[model samples]
Target chain A: MAARKSSQSHSGGLELLFSNQRKHKVSIPSTSDATTGQPSNVAFLIKWLCDNLMRDPRKEMFVLDDTARPGILVLINDADWELEGEEKYELQAGDEVVFVSTLHGG
Target chain B: MNGFSGTDHQVHNLKQQIAATETQLHSLKLQLQQAEQQAEAARHLSEAYQGGFPAEWMDETLVALQQDVTRDIAQKVRQEGGFEGAPSVRDAAQPRRWPLEKHEYKRYGRQLIMPEVGLHGQLRLKNARVLIVGVGGLGCPAAAYLAGAGVGTLGLMDGDTVEESNLHRQIAHSTARVDMNKTQSAMEYLQSLNPHVNYNRHEFHLTPQKAIQIFEQYDLVLDCTDHPTSRYLISDACILTGKTLVSASALKTEGQLIVLNNPPRPPGDALGGPCYRCIFPKPPPAESVLSCGEGGILGPVVGVMGVLQALEAIKVLTARAQRPANGGDWSTNGATSEAAPKATLLMFSTYNTPQFRSVRLRSRRADCAACSAQSTISRQSLTSGSLDYVAFCGATAPINLLPPASRVTATDFSRLPRDGSNVLIDVRDETQYAICALRGSVNVPWTGSADTWLERALASGLSFGGGRQHFVMCRFGNDSQLAAKAVMERTQTPVAVKDVKGGFKSWRDEVDPSWPDY
Candidate 1:
């Protein structure tokens, strides 16, 4: 039921997708608006994640401040965020944003 | 009538002078034609012999003619200009020869046959001096490939010693070299592979004071280091020293490669390629970072990135040394002047469909603190140790959430009852537990939920009677603390939960000498 609600919201609001490899999965809100009632962008979406999904937002043990984190690659509609103006790239209806981490040992 | 007669006499004298000049011009033309024939014959002879004939026995006249033709052809080519589009005639005329021994040719014959990397490119490779920062998973394969390609000099820098755990992905180090200095171990392996390569070993760790000085000695720098501090340090050092950096990083099943701070073609007319800071101005919070030991990585994923790093390094080194011969499409662009080298970032994911993607990176920022003309991170600044890379990248604070009472040292934990009355939970991953584990210990991998496992264990009557304590452990005691906290939070009944201090590493060092360390 939660998965269906999140999928239905994908057509209405910004479709946020995590790379399947991520450790945790959270249900996206069905409404088209951000939790703060502001237009959803990358920074606001990150805040939404921390406030709603994370176990402890104060400790931020699960996720760091995504805006400043260097290792996480953000893709906007399959293009690099760097090409899409990074965090400044505004989210549109049905816009898909994907986040993947690049910080692991080689 | 007297003036007309004087004019006629003057005209007759002028005609006689012109006749004498014409005769001289005709004779000079004949001589020029003979010289042209001689030069043409010499060129034909040279082309036919193809340098097989000994120069000492050749006619003096023929040698002079051959030299003249070469000079004239080179001059004409120069006059035409913009041969950046064409296969350089000068390059083709004087075929580059590898200055090394015959054995080197046999050693790198496979690489030499590639049209992009012919004799000229091989010679360039032989002249390259590359510095590989870390002799870990990424550095091992990169250094191996560079050595096999006959890179003239390799500088390996690492302070850590090889461990049995490193043998899985750090392929350059073998089981025999366990406990040996990583730099020394890697050098021994590389030297065995190619004795001709000059190995420069830096046994000390990379500090800003030493990074700039060491980077200045090498033509290219490879950021194979895992930590963010080392990544920023290598990028800054390469920028300050005017050396190209081929940086590669792999984590889990993903890897990334980027060539940073590549010097502009004309050198300093415009800015060089983007430095690491231009893209990643700051590092992620230290709490979010995880090493391969903690996160785990596929060996081949890192190997793929390492191999790509070597490939990019070869391209940069060869392109810098000589223009690509044989009209090779190695040219990144057609424009000659004001063409800043393009920076590209490559991302590879081995999961799912196994995808490799490349994105064009932005050019060097005019205000970039490291690589720009008026930047702040100068060689002097680095040498003075004013730029603290570790502090800049935020030091990883010691993970000490639980109080001292909730944690027990390895020495104390070793003395605990090994009988079935007490339960010891090893929180390391299955792979690590398979390697080596203590007796009478149950394996519970440190995942998101410790409560689920604890509930199952309690229901199964593993923790049966009174006075039984649950002790959690991990590789280095970090994850064990988290596990202990999780269990403490979830248990409703009166139960004692404590983590082993310093994990199994400390156990191996302080408690038992026989336990094999990863």
Candidate 2:
């Protein structure tokens, strides 16, 4: 697995761990300064997480509805998407979204 | 006879030697034992303090160093033609002082233009130096609104980096900002939001020296930081500087706002006027309360409070007269002076039943270390020797006597058995599951409330009542844990339930992060 970044104490408790299973970086179109390659649009982010980043729903890592977006954890900085909004949340260019599997421990 | 005499002498000599040898041996053993103990203690201390930098490591490092770079920026900007942004000064007062932009007049803008605010109020805001200590959930919205409302110059102070987990409610940042410094990231966003407003970024912790120095420069201070240490520091700094403070918080659905000013003023006809300490003199135990980060909050919930803060800041700048006091306690409600004073306190509840209240805050505590210090240097000195205020405020201590579990990373996580032992059961999504997971146990992907999950688990015959225990887990171990705890409270079940320390990630490293470090 690729090394993931750990959340610091003072920054609240947000740990960003991405799936090391994929070797390639998925490109999400930048809506904010298009020339800057930064993704500022929330809709684009949802599409990116659902289509490119999310794995097959049938897989352990991918556990969202087959017709819907894959089960992904959207952390705005370190907060969860469920508490805020799902993919509908507006994203600035420099913010981060960590993709994790929803299969959870059994 | 001669033989008898020789025997007695020999016996006496042998006894003396034996006694001397015994004393020597005892002293040597004691010294050896003490040396061993010291070595053991040193080794343990090293283990306890050693580690990869925490997510807030940068923040901590900034605190450890000296030199208030943030203060320097504020002072420099204060002296050298204001922040690089929109024209700040307005007309009427200092002519040719600077080109003053006349704020476009609007109706019910009474709050914006009351006599106090007139042209002078706008200038105070324009010339004001406000330092926001954190840019997380509370800090993010507070700072953003402050900038948008045109609080002339804003100082963003936070030593933390953005993380993916914070995306939930920290709207200030986006996914791209992960691993970036929060203060710098926020500053960039604030500047973009309002090009005309000048913003200063303090990519360091709020040391007393820095806090006092910066506090001295600013007209008011806003406490949006999360931790107790920072809260106390902000409070102390404000009192010492005689500046107003707009402190706000939102944990889960409940939110609070307190406005404190130096030289505490009585609640004339106004709503509530109380210092931050009046409501909470000292920081509460960390475990006694849960933060929005740990407790979970709705997005708009915080947004509401953030906007209110802007209103309060504007109110202070605009109010013309004292509020006419009604026959009510100002502490529970906000000040209602028809003539709002230049300094006041305002607090509210955004979620559930929304209530607007203000109180008259008590003046500086004669013994307040932050304020009321005879010597400025003495006040500055207190911050360094001050016990880690966060910990001293009881934020660091674990609530449970069972022992506060230490946090370990996925790299260091070691899984244990799941045979219904002393562990807590966490059943949340896999993504959350990956970052923090308990080893060798039942993993049920349970989302939603406890009532929903419990009813389903029971109807499904999951046998949660079995010898095996369950401790529900979620990110920050908030909702699920609360659900589980609530279930236990209502049912009084005999199940050994305990929320994993720091939830899953905490458990993974401290208990067993290896279960699956995603």
Candidate 3:
């Protein structure tokens, strides 16, 4: 059997804080945009969230934690980030990166 | 000789007076008949109000009245205090369209092209009444699609409140309605999505006793419920009542949907042919089934099953498809297939491929208590009588369900001020800021997200400190509560935040109506 470890066991507080797995997409200016007042895209937004909002900053395009969906289920239009390598979700100037939790209902 | 000739002139004068008096009497009779017709029109409105609408609907009417923004502005603000600065009818300049309309089914449109649901079927869909059991994942999307299809009456049965977790899949509740009644909140959302639909929210739980009452009201019942016991109970009730039951369930990238028709004859036929029990009698042991809570389910899996359930319901309600022939038969190939063992049940398991499965559901079990009386073990004759099946289904179990809180308009907040310390927040778009605003509250309008409001609020140099007791409010209570929750999170403030129940409309209804409610 594959080793199973619950990701939520470590950071319960963070889980409680970001428990609303609702998809809220926020587009903010990048650091250059923040410092120089410029518009930010997915790349800059991803970096800013990691530095400010996320507790652990991994060099990934999307942040996946137990706080929201099961894993960091990232959607870039029609592709899943999990299918790509970690942090490999490429961001173009006009690309939209939607970070959704993997929660299912039947 | 001159005195005798003057008599003819006197006779002409008498005839003129008699003609004028007759005209006056005719006019009076006409006035009385017109007055009676006016009185009859008023009586119809009163009768419709008393007959169709129940007493509990007072809240809905009060909410609607409070949200009235048909009045003028400046005088309204002075009387009502701060305007929420939201757009009213004047801004949109769009005329208010009445909700009630007798629409003939439009043919030659997009729906007519669909082979399965054509013009004839569309008319049936319009008149169909589908009762949805839950408002969770499967229920939310399915109901939305069904409403969009122009179903006349959509009945939502849920006694649960909205929680933060439901926000993930239950897209019906907005952030503004963080803690409102789920049934009421979902109904409002569904109406806004499609004004033509007439929906009623059953705030009470679907108990066995209540089941008979509610299920009998709808043409079809969809079993979107979770637990096995509840599913079995629903199946049994559908059998007894002779209502078409559209049953669907999904979990973890898998789903299943089945349409159970009551007997072979008309619903209330003498012989209650084969029911869900005539096929599978006893409830499967509890351990065999797992819920989304234990084994996670894919969100799309539920979406897929729910859509199928809705389609099946649309079909059954319009009488396009005949009831299941014999016990659990679902063969669309031909009626002669009834003899084939391979053609009985219709099942879909998303585990492998999204193909429908056909299986033969065996005959009535001899020991099955529902169908088998003397041949089976009589539950009444047993030492330890069968447990209350309803209770076994957790009829008394607390629904640990949650959605978001309710949003009150400014009017609702005024009435409930005595209940607790409450404050209002305005969340209108900035472009319409010149219109009006609520005074003594914060303005965080949804200028696009957490940052826009924060930037604008910080730039204003306003004081939002001291962890003040506050409730978020909006024009219609749609966006304010969402903004408030987001604000509470960003501020790291543990505040007892709630949406002003009903937004500015409630405020206008209870306090001052001079304010525009648009």
Model 3 chain B, poorest ten-residue lDDT window?
B92-101
Tell me the deviation in Å of residue B113 in model 1: 3.1
Summarize candidate 2's per-residue lDDT along B219-292 as a digit string, tens digits: 66777676556666676666555566777766544455656652233322122233444334444434334455
lDDT at B99, model 1? 36
Fnat of candidate 1: 0.56
Predictions' DockQ, in order? 0.32, 0.01, 0.07
Q: TM-score winner among the candidates? A: 1
- Candidate 2 per-residue C-alpha lDDT over A1-106 given as tens digits, one digit per residue, 9 for 90 to 100: 1222222111111111123232223444445345664434545554445465533332222223331223233344545443346555656434555432211000
Q: CAPRI verdict on model 2?
A: incorrect
The runs of at least 3 residues in candidate 2 whose Cα sits more than 4 Å from the true structure, single-residue gaps closed, are A1-106, B1-117, B262-274, B319-351, B354-380, B383-387, B395-503, B506-518
| Chain A only: TM-score per candidate | 0.53, 0.42, 0.37
Error of 3 at B334 (Å): 7.8
- What's model 2's overall lDDT? 0.51
Worst 10 residues of 2 chain B by lDDT: B90-99
Per-residue lDDT tens digits for candidate 3, residues B320-398, read 4432446653223222433312113344445433345433334333344444342332223222334356444333332
Cα lDDT tens digits, model 1, B1-518, are: 99999999999999988876765565455446555655567666567556554453235335444554455455544444433355544532331222335686688889877866665567668777999998999999999999999999999989999988888889999999999999999999999999999999999789988887788789888889898888888888887777778999887777889888766321233446788877677676675677887777889989999999999988877654323546642233223456565577787877534378666666776666776666778778788998888788788766797988999999998787667666888878788899998777888776545665566456645553376888889888888888888777776666788899999989989999888754
